[model samples]
Target: MFFGSRKGSEHNSGQDKVISMDRFRDGSSLSPIRQAEAYWTALRQGEDVPKRSQIDPRGLENILSQTFILERIAPGIARFRLAGQKLNEMAGMEVRGMPLTAFFTPTARKQVSAALEHMFDAPAVVELSLQTEATRNRPSQEARMLLMPLRSDLGDVSRALGVFVSEGNSMKTSQRFNVTATELRPVTPLLKPKMSPASKSPNEVNAGFAETQAKFSDEPSVMDEARALVEASRQSMDEARKSLSEIGKPTEKTKPSRSSHLRLVVSRD
Candidate 1:
């Protein structure tokens, strides 16, 4: 009951713009793949990758059964953190916690791992065409799968949004798919907004400090005041020198001769 598988088929791999649903034929059974992609794209809203938390199942109501979320545990390896009913039916059991490679043939597992690595490393969008072989009681089936990078709550590109849709009758047994073609589209990050300069104020001084209220004046500078003080000091020093010179010289020796010629009387004490 597995999907169709063929050997020696060339894989069509390319880098292109975001895929458009209109590019596929109208009423294609794999349209759900494109629908899921479209939902992820809309969530991007100009971002390189949409946040995993931004994913709302309500937006994907129509294709919810085919959508799953993946958490990258290592390079070239990812496991299903959340899977839809279709995946469970394909695996004939709950597919949660299972590696994505489980859904692919052993030979195709390498290709699937490479695709997962590219989607997470390049942070690109990936689409794969899968085919499963028919058994005696089952018919061959064709499927389309989409993997889009998403940012986790921590802003790391460790999570992905995926959709897997197959065209054919439901299988009672577990199934696996073979990679036939792959398309990779590298994403462009959004540019940050630039900051504008602050507007100039009439007053040159900044407004917050206490000095903001001080006015500019044309008063003498500090050098001018220093020169005036020096001149005053020099004058005082010159006057003090002259006064000392006068005191040092002989002064008015004959002025008190007449009145000072007093008789000297010796008195017994």
Candidate 2:
């Protein structure tokens, strides 16, 4: 008795269910940042942070151009210990020995400084979303940056491994970026503490299916006891046989006796 458009209803339902999944995909444009973070995480192993000396250029060959190493010279201040060609290109000069704040605009420098301080102090992972101001000749660009804390040879969290990736066309002049967002993630230890023997109970210390009240002793085994019993039985049997033989034979104190009256009886037909 009711008239309805089934096809139209189904089409509307399908349209409503449509969802954008691009955010879940690892896009090519942001591959460098992901690669750098993955490499750092792998190097950490079970430690809070990886050592600076443990970093190898070979491990990050594909993203080497976008990678850089930072050394914390002072609180909230770090300079490029080593920088890649990509960073150099963006700065329009060699970025080594230059402060990381040089890559950011004046307004964003304080935020970057605070983030850097937190990264070295808290020794946490830092990520920054960045953008460039558009001009009449240059278009605005978006970028992502990652900073992972590292320990120096002396075992101090003053070193960092970092990566910078920018999207869209590159500017001919030096391009400074503004910090749009910052993310700080605390690092966790990968290894768990072991339980000491003192912490375990006496029963738990023994590694068997059943518990026994018997104390440990230097006694012989069950096989040894069985062997001893067998030896004693054999000696008793030998003694009995010897006694029978001695009784049957004439002894020094007894005179020889005549043979018994029993005769051998054999029946042959």
Candidate 3:
């Protein structure tokens, strides 16, 4: 399927710095996930996350079963949490004590290497189609995989987390996420009369550059920009927060529709 659903994750290894505690304590409007989101915002912005090895597996185990299949895929690879016996069997046999390279057929192995490398190279989520044992060695029935990086507090790439989402005949749609934002020089054509530093002089061209330079001086550093980009992600994540709120709202006894069953996955890179 060309179109697929979007997935997300939260990094809660560190203290809950990013979350809003007030609303949560009173159990007013904000939910646990929302409060946890604050922690996630800080994590995304480069706050130190405890090493996974240092983390209590049991502490996260309950969250894992509720979310993804949380076993290590290889030396530095982990699969997004998956459910059911099939996933467990696959992990048990080849992925646990092995490098991910072991699972791919030789030709596919090369591709897997490249894909995993790409995940390490960037902090964005990547999607691809892959063959699985469940496919019966046939060409069709491929599982869609999304590779995301999990990082350490030092801002180094830690583990690459991937999700193998199955797509049947139905259509799939994947939402695009902005992992990083670059500082770009403004070009005239795309320019609108947005707010700029106050500078009025006869020579407009030189004045514009001078003003831009000054603005940059007062603006965020590269590190701060990184923080903003991560904080900005909260806007995108608000959708999930809203869903959780609706779920928590008291209502007549009824199971929510699959319309709300949309699954969102995130590889903490």
Best candidate (score: TM-score) = 2
Model 3 C-alpha lDDT versus the unseen true structure: 0.42
lDDT tens per residue, model 3, 1-269? 12223334254333333445565545435332333323333334332322333333343332232223233345434444334333334444323334554544555655555555555554344455555443333333454444444555565655543333343323222211111211211111222456554544333345434443322235568999988999889877998799988997888888866655667898999
Each prediction's whole-model lDDT (CA)? 0.83, 0.86, 0.42
Order of the predicted models by TM-score, top scorer first: 2, 1, 3
lDDT of 2 by residue, 1-269 (tens): 22334455755444434455565553444588887888888898788999999999999887788899999998889999999888888888898999999999999999999999999888799999999898999888889899999999999999999998865346557889999999999888877668775565554445655564355566799999999999999999999999888887865687778887988999996
Candidate 2 residue-wise lDDT at 19: 54
Deviation (Å) of 139 in candidate 1:
2.2
Where does model 1 exceed 4 Å of error? 1-30, 190-269
* All candidates: TM-score: 0.59, 0.62, 0.33
Q: Residue 94: error of model 3 in Å?
A: 6.0
Q: Name the 10 consecutive residues with the lowest summed lDDT in model 1.
A: 1-10
Model 1 lDDT on a 0 to 1 scale: 0.83
Higher-lDDT candidate among 1 and 3?
1
